[model samples]
Target: MGLNVPTVSTGKKYTIEDYLKLDDGQSYELIEGELILVPRPRTKHQKIANRFFANLDRFVLMNNLGEVNGDVDVYLEEEVVAPDVFFVAKERLTIVGEMNIQGAPDLVVEVLSPSTARYDRKKKSRLYFRNGVKEYWLADPDQQLVEVLVAGEKEWKWIGVFDREDILTSNLLPGLEINLGEIFR
Candidate 1:
């Protein structure tokens, strides 16, 4: 019988140090050691992200609960992901580094565009879930809906898909709320 063994990775594997060496002019994520460049968001995409960020940031800051950030790097052992919006509780602020957060944020939000829909829903979800993100939001501008997911024992469990008429409530932020109608406007 042949010996059982694990195969070596032929693909290039870059670390956090390597990720830091990249030019700061562009946005990128390191997934499984490969650099994946993120497309620049369109006007509609930026509007959605900005609106949500404004509401969320104000609430979190006023409550002294945590800090809300936009397009910031959340670092993992072998990967670096820049969620469109992410919140880190005040107590967990130690993870915040000079260049990036050392670990996962409490919540990670990704506002999807046509070019990045599949990657955001699949790869990013898996990455955030595996890295101990407590909550994840996938905001779809095309569908005008937001899907909320909470981490579970095995995987992220979908809480619900909220429409423009529904008020979006975040589980991580307890009592924070946002009007989807205003956000989608």
Candidate 2:
């Protein structure tokens, strides 16, 4: 799962239209203009993502708050990203464009894999914060932990890391609490 070679850069910048024109079968992300290949999720990563998605989906649906989606194209202007899971409140559905999300989502969840852990924590976190993502969650299956980050006016602020023993809760998604123990198990 480790990416022996770091990000494979194109050495050239690309536009959103150009990115869309590429083969959809391949997994990639447009980072600042560099087309970086995203590695396939490992079985453990997929399992964690699926479990978290199910929990978030159920909560959002029951409360009629918003919609929860997985691996969808999210357009952050020139940079297009596909977060592991994203949630947009019902009131902010306008950002959900026909092709892809035109703006940052209310909340984004990323299940870390060995290859993309650093990228997700560094590049993607900064991107999400700058683009107006209210909240971000980094789920680490190996550590069995979830790090919650809240967006501030200037930067992203760390809320806290919840381990398997703690019940994960989101300040943005009020009443949306998830048991970490279930996810790690």
Candidate 3:
């Protein structure tokens, strides 16, 4: 048996603005300067996003923490990131830019799907921390766990890793109590 295999490569080369402007009925994200197009997920992913956003929506309203934005383009100078769910505190609500979020948000929450887990954990995490993002949450929909990151003196420090059994807490929010089960249930 002698069969030679051929390598096939395919993807789009897109800039930050190009990727942002492409609302061509496709679900995609920018990772490491690359625009990756993702197919629609299984039903489970939708459920996780719904549950997490539902409770987070209530928490922000009750505590007056500005707004919880989903599918919003947030600009960090050279980088434009779109976290699964992002929370901007009232203090940083003075953004007056042309076509992007002015700066870093108080909290950036990412829901882990197979498509963007590595990019979220590695590339964007570094970007957020470097730009003085206070809190970064990595929510694992498959595992039902969330990893919390807080800005530190040198770098972003891992404050804690929480699961469904634990009550999610945030230092930036003062008296905010988020139920872990509501995230990935």
Q: Who wins the lDDT comparison?
A: 2
lDDT of 1 by residue, 80-166 (tens): 888899899999999988777889999988999877777788877898999899999999998999999999999999899999999
Model 1: CA > 4 A from native: 1-11
lDDT of candidate model 3 versus the reference:
0.72
Where in model 2 is the C-alpha error above 4 Å? 1-6
Ten contiguous residues minimizing lDDT sum, candidate 2: 1-10
Per-prediction count of colliding residue pairs?
0, 0, 0
TM-score of each: 0.90, 0.94, 0.81
Measured on C-alpha atoms, candidate 2 has an lDDT of 0.88
C-alpha root-mean-square deviation, candidate 1: 6.3
Query: Best to worst by lDDT, what's the order?
Result: 2, 1, 3
Q: List the residue pairs that clash in candidate 3.
A: none
For residues 12-103, write the lDDT of model 3, one tens digit per residue: 54567776677688766554555656556567766776666777778888888877666666777655666667777776777524455777
Which residue pairs in model 1 clash with each other? none
All candidates' lDDT scores?
0.86, 0.88, 0.72
Q: 1-185 in candidate 2: lDDT tens per residue?
A: 44331554667788888898888687878877778788888899999999999999999999998889879889897998999988999999888876678889999999998778888998899899989999999999999999999998899899999999999888888898899999999
Estimate the overall C-alpha local distance difference test score of candidate 1: 0.86
For model 3, what is the error of residue 166's alpha carbon versus the real structure, in angstroms, after optimal superposition? 1.0
Better of 1 and 2 by TM-score: 2
Name the candidate, 2 or 3, with the larger TM-score value. Answer: 2
